[model samples]
Target: MRDLSPPAPRARGALGVAAAVLMAAATLAAPAHAAAAPAGGTAEAAVTAPAPPMGFTNRDSTRCRAEFDEAYVKKIADILVAKGLKDAGYTYVNLDDCWARPARDDQGRLVPDPVRFPNGIKALADHVHAKGLKFGLLAGAGARTCDPAGFPGSLGHEAGDARQFADWGVDHLTYADCGGGGDAEQRYAAMSDALRATGRPVVLTVADQGANRSWEWDGDVAQVRRTTGAGTDGWGSVLARVKQNLPLAAHTGPGRWNDPDALHVGGYGMTETQYRTQFSLWSVMAAPLVIGSDLRKLDAVSAEILTNREVIAVDQDPRGKPGEVVASDAGRWVISKELADGSRAVALFNETNRPRHIATTAGAVGLPAASGYKARDLWTALEKGTSGTIAATVPAHGTVLLKVSADREWSQLPPLLDTTISGDAVARPGTTQRVASAVTNHGGAATGTVTLTLTGGDGWTAQPVTAASTDRLKAGATLGTEWDVTVPAGATGRHELTLTTKYRSRDGLTFTSAIPVPVLVGVTRPPAGESYLGDQAPLAATNGWGPVEKDLSNGESNAGDGSPITINGTVFAKGLGVNSPSSVEYYTAGRCTRVTAQVGLDDEAGTQGTVTFEIWADHQQVASIPKMTNADAARSLTADVSTAETVRLVVTDGGDGAAYDHADWADLKITCA
Candidate 1:
């Protein structure tokens, strides 16, 4: 097995070296191409790249389907107009997966199911374009669509498929796992190249499912990449996707954005508050605001969520910076984005099961109270004045989205710490405790030789465990270290542990954490033969035992043979045969010992019954009251056994007739003294 421990400094350096070598190899294999020349003979140039077709939009039927009909299509056009989505810059109405048919026609062209799309894709695109919108389509990278055995895949048929989509007026195309083919990047590039050759400026949306960290490099090949799975309307799903995509914010741009799948707002399985929270998060993340609900049937709350201009502004901001989490805890979180106008858009989210008051000072978010700010609650449509700081009572799984501008002038505020720290703690014997601290440097400049002191309790000693020698933390990076300290052993009640970090320019800050370590005097074990035993049967139900006899013949049983069992339980056979050639055995946990049993026909064995027995703690098997077995009779035979440590038990079939040589067990039990 590979070592799971964190890599040493030398090993990390070596990994960087290996990455450089791999990049060099890739560069050599495929020489970088030059950008196409611009129309004017100036030094500037234009770049031509493979992209998704123009009119594609991702759709989810579980939430809403982009069905093709005059009424439905017109309704979507109207909703887009009413919401001003078109004005804000959303155009294509792309159909995601699950919209295709099972087979293609003899002409090798995909056939849209007439029942769902009677006017066909072309008519739908025409209608959308007439309304100033575009139509897009979806297909799988594998042989079959997301559907089991659906339409033919777009693997080797990339060129033909591109032409087909072009002919159908497809403006955008979303491809997933393409034909489930070659390397993810290579396959995506191939499809993009194929689409580009079709003389159509189709916008290519590569759905890599975020596998292999493709979002980090896919920007060069596709217009956008899905950074997470298909989205759900649930708040948990939205929060999870947002947190996962935050690291990829640096990769987003005008032509490419990190898609947190689609908008689940106003969809099923979400409350009004949740929908608002979802919209706020997606907008802050700069994710595509592709609505995934029945636009015509939207409720009032859904309409409000989808049309919030302030929230939408953060998403459609020209700067295109994805928001990053600035503060996060069990109940609250804060994410911030740098806007193009030298301002910041901050979102304070409350994701607990209940309402919470999430507060953050201006300094915490890198803002000065001297710069008076205006806070707008996106969900409530209310505006509040702030004196360089903001705080609010956010509902459960809800948020307060704000736009903080530094244009306002106010009195200067005291200097404060810009760094934040988070960590976990564990208890140890004596007066010592172990704590791991993750220090985040949010300041513009790097910090050096910082000291973290632990105070309080009767006696406390702090010693750095890791990252101490360097004593430097770089800007925008986090440094983790452990500290071992001694606290009075007799301390029983909660005591405060203060962390103080000193820097020259920045003010020294103190953060207090309460720690309670209970004292344990002694440990005890259960009395002999009364200890609990852990045992479980295998999950599979089958006819043959492993590596043992394929089939049991005559009056023989396949019990315990070749199987491991805990000897804690009573060993038994459901249906046992006397005078049969059948037996089974099991190995103990340590494999130190084996137990076996055999039943033989007695001279006076006239009646058909069962033979019961028990095993004692001394590893001795004892016969209990004897029971009779009649001719062609089936009966259960059980035996209880005990051992010093733990052991295994085996039961064998001893019977006369071949038909009576089997025993079946419905249940087994283990009893402690």
Candidate 2:
């Protein structure tokens, strides 16, 4: 899987080939429109080509260090075919890392480790193909694989590896986790064009691991993309992957699936029930049916769970629509998927340690309550009968997967609850403030009376506020309200305004949802000629949003003024490297005329590194220090920020890099003209 790392040195020719692939994509990219559907199940979706492989994969998920030889690969392929997996859409068995030598041959050709694959890749492909299953291999975006001893990956060798795999009859090729280097989008596109040149269809799987937010860029390239990191064995790991992929349902469709790594079932760290939870969630998401546990050591319960046709059918549904996590509270959650025949596959999960009694009406889950629907348990394969209200007692970490079909058409299901708090994005301290909130009716029917409360810490108050109260709200309706809030005097930091509301769903189950309102509370303006920013009063940054940080290293490196700390303060902003941008913002009741400070790098020798400081008046960049380095010496800095309502101080990395780009803003001050 990919990670968040800077572009590392890549193969020599990758950039050149990347340019060519971009030109091809610009000309070939086209959107697939929604197509007509047949009644019942089995309708095809409007999907892009080289997509919708509808198969299985076995990576090293079960055993991170498990290395299989050619015989074991064939054995798994034979097992897949024998267990009727091939017929049910489990058709691809991929070879991960460890199969090839670390370096290429004299001719620069990737050579599989002779000891591991004596018959070579071609013979293995034949064996997989003979079993009516497809064969696949792995490559990385970097020059080397993630494995220290793994073969060189497919960076510059894209043109060669793509052709070689096609020649060997490989139908699937996974660009596994990168070597934490190079432009990910460009490298993947290079391989995309190379595979196309062979005139053979090969499905591309991008296991980019969400590093560069690859989902947005890889959509037009890889058919299936990994939305999370490499999978590990543990219930926490299983749930961790699930938590990452559920919200990305909107990004998935007919041919594209948001892979949450794989179905690492029947392995250590998970119980029988937890295994079913993993299976149910993957199926609901229309994910690949790739099971990574050793097939040779399958037990009765594991086989029964894996071979469940109903669950597999959800993943293989021809409609190509994936189920999504519609609503969740505490440990109780709901996930619903649209089916091919206008039906819906819904799952209710109890993720906590105690049993939970969950309930939902048919109309609440997008089914017409008027039309009685028949239900069945996917796990037990038992006919669970029909009713307008489907309720169950789900054990901890267990789920209820229901296939609901109605004889008559149903009214659309409403969003369970939609609440938003606005108008408080920015607030001034020491004053009564007002914010607006809008709550909508996303249930099947009308709701009862609702109570809302606004709460905050640090002596904040929201006691006396008036707005419209709701006695009842019809389906799909909205109610608007307001709140007058106030933070304590001199509150000069980012604070959260929480709105806690109690509402009951259409099925009469009450839920408490707390919504956070992010607001920056500013302090009073500094007197003219007074120091408001420096080592002592470091520019307070917005935690999750701003990259600027506070540190005390000026004296340690003799950064500027030969002071250990800020001129008279204790901290300064640092970590200002390339792409490591940091900023501090504060509101002023009175306009500030100018800002001044002393800045320098923290290089031990004072010979390397760079820093660029910019000042933003409101949202506009009014002044900047273009490029300063260690050799440039610590110097006085000034910027005209006159009549500025909001002022921001930003420190940036120098041109070369941020290796030792330590900077200090000593005696930083903002003053009036």
TM-score of each: 0.53, 0.55
lDDT tens readout by residue for model 2, 60-156: 5432254578878888888887777676667778887777877888987888778879999989988888777777888877777766664588888
Model 2 lDDT, residue 432, Cα: 82
Clash list (residue pairs), candidate 2: 1-177, 2-208, 368-410, 415-442, 535-570, 535-571, 536-569, 536-570, 548-582, 555-564
lDDT of 1 by residue, 1-673 (tens): 1111222222223453343234223322221122222112122211211111111133553323445444565567767777766654556677666555676788777777676677777777677777777666787776666654456677767767877777777766778774466677666666666665555555577776575466655554566787765554455456556656777777665556677677766667678777877878878887777777666567777766676767777786755567877887754888887777766788888865434556676656666445455555565554433455555556556777887655342212111122233332223335565666544443334555555554555565667777632355554456566877675655442244555555332233322222222222111212333222213221111121111222121122234342221111223332122222122222122212222233222212324323222222223443322332433222333344433333222222221112221223222333433
Best by TM-score: 2
Candidate 2 local accuracy as lDDT? 0.63
Q: lDDT for every model? A: 0.51, 0.63
Worst 10 residues of 1 by lDDT: 538-547
Model 1 residue runs over 4 Å out of place are 1-58, 62-71, 82-89, 98-101, 104-108, 114-119, 367-371, 380-383, 409-673
